[model samples]
Target: MKEKIESKLREKFPNAILEVNDFRGDLTFLVDKNSIVEICKFLRDDEELSFDLLVDLCGVDRAKRKDRFEVVYHIVSLKNRYRVRLKVRVDEKDCVVDSVTSVYPTANWHERETYDMFGITFRNHPDLRRMYMPEEFEYYPLRKDFPLMGIPGSLQLPKR
Candidate 1:
């Protein structure tokens, strides 16, 4: 099944898929950020693959890598009972990628949370606002460089 999926993905987007990995039966595909939406749509709509459920969406801060951020998506095919993970590498300077809400509406909140925690923006997201942090908060707490104590005066507590 992994081989079939990988072959199909390669056939569909030969240039967009950067790497493929299978570890302990889990399949992971590292793909180009530019075509993430298209690739996801294919995974969901393709009858042979049919990755219908968007299980999770999150971000990883790769501070030292050429691409400083990685947006990860976990998808499952209910019909086939197969799961696959997709990742898109995002450059720190850009820190932006197209929202997958169109492909999977569940990604709306996930994307917002990723944005709030990692400062990675999802372009074209219906509501790309802070999910866990206050609207006025300035720093992304999950980034590697974010100070553990946080920015001075960034948060104001009510006077006791």
Candidate 2:
């Protein structure tokens, strides 16, 4: 199953793939952000490889790395009883990635939550806005560099 999925992706997206990792039977592909939407579409539409379920979508912040962020998609083919982990690295300079909401409608909230937490924007998202933080919040609280004690007066408190 892994071989089939890897071969198809390699053949179809030769230039878009960056790295492939298999740890404890879990397969992860780090791919180019530019091809993320197409790759996901193909993954979902392919008849033989029907990845019909998007189990999870989230973001990672790697502040020390040159590409400071990674958006991860955990998708599974319930028919095939297998899953693939797709990842796209995002640079801090251009922290935008094309949204996968078209391919997976459930991605809407995940993308918004990621944006609110990591400050990584998802282009073409239906409603991209803060999920937990206020709209005026200036800093992403989840980043490794965020102050532990919270930003002083970052948000206004209601009079009790």
Candidate 3:
């Protein structure tokens, strides 16, 4: 089941960096950040593989990678009964990926939440603002390097 979807995705997106995480039975593909919108459109609309559901979109911060941020798209095909995960890496200086809200309406809020936590800007995401975090917080807390507690000069920690 996974191989069939992978082959079709390869045929459809030849340049996408494709990988099969067989240990967990997940189809993971990485495409250039700029091509995200195009790739997502193909996945959702292709007749043979109608991945009509955008399950989630989020970011993963790779502390060791030169490109520090990865935007991950979790998609499911209700008609075909298949799933795939798409990833695109972006540099910390330019942590941005194309928004898929136009293709999948559900992506709007997901993108906002991702942006709020990971600081990966979804270009053209409608209402890209902090969904759950306080508005006063200036930095994204989910990045691997972001400090959980401030240094000594800052507020005191809760009693342990």
Top lDDT model: 1
lDDT per model, in order? 0.95, 0.94, 0.82
Model 1, span 48-114: residue lDDT tens = 8899999999999988999899999999999899999999999988989999999999999999999
lDDT of 3: 0.82
lDDT of 2 by residue, 32-149 (tens): 9999999999999999999989999999988899999999999999899998999999999999999999999999999999999999999999999999988899999889899888
What are the TM-scores, per candidate, against the unseen true structure? Answer: 0.97, 0.96, 0.86
Off by over 4 Å in 1: none
Compute the lDDT of residue 25 as modeled in candidate 3.
73
lDDT of 3 by residue, 1-160 (tens): 6767778777777776545465477778877788788888987888878899999888888988999988889999999888888888889898778899999999999889888888888888878889887676677778877788733443444689
Model 1 clash pairs? none
Error of 2 at 10 (Å): 0.8
